[model samples]
Target: MPRTPRTFTVSDSIVVAASPEAVYGQVSRPALTGRWSPENLGATVHGTGGADRETYVGMVFDGHNKRGPARWSTRCTVTAADAGERFAFRVHAIGLRTPRLRGPIA
Candidate 1:
């Protein structure tokens, strides 16, 4: 068998009392995703800047995820960044402990 790229998108929205900037500020951080996301266990940044760095297109991070007892990680690159508007990333690789399977998984 051969691995093939797959498209996966997860998105939801709820009305908030705060401004868009405040909402974006909270969701933009890969480290804080665990709070709102069910499978995400946050992320481990690949370099020195860490996940605390400013959000921008092309920013890379390792997404830590879990389902019941199964655990996995995915390499993601920020594909969209519009402060106070939108933030998105694409999963380019995945693995048990690290992103060793290089290709799109989500």
Candidate 2:
């Protein structure tokens, strides 16, 4: 059987009554995401420097995530990081195993 490629996109936003610097301080730190994000369990910085290091463009790290009974890790790389402006990272699931779902069972 042939497999079809799949693409997924997720977006979220929150309004915080705080300075940009304060918000950036929390968002830029990968270790802190677990505290706020529901899906993200936690993250650890890779390749030395510091465990809770600030993310910069091109920085690589690993993220731990969980969804129901399934848990997985992802390799992430920071693509954009502008102080008090924007911080974005790309995630690639590691050792992911997709279950076969032929038709709508439900």
Residue-wise lDDT of candidate 1 within 15-96, one digit each (tens)? 8999999999988999889888999999887667887888888888999999999999999999998999999998989999
Give the per-residue lDDT digits (tens) of candidate 2, residues 67-104.
99987667777888999998888764463332232332
Q: What is the lDDT of residue 14 in candidate 1?
A: 79
- Worst 10-residue lDDT window, candidate 1: 5-14
Per-model TM-score, in order, reads: 0.84, 0.75
Give the C-alpha lDDT of model 2: 0.73
Q: What are the runs in model 2 whose C-alpha is more than 4 Å off?
A: 1-9, 96-106
**How many clashing residue pairs, candidate 2?**
0
Clashing pairs in 2: none
Compared with the true structure, model 1 gives a TM-score of 0.84
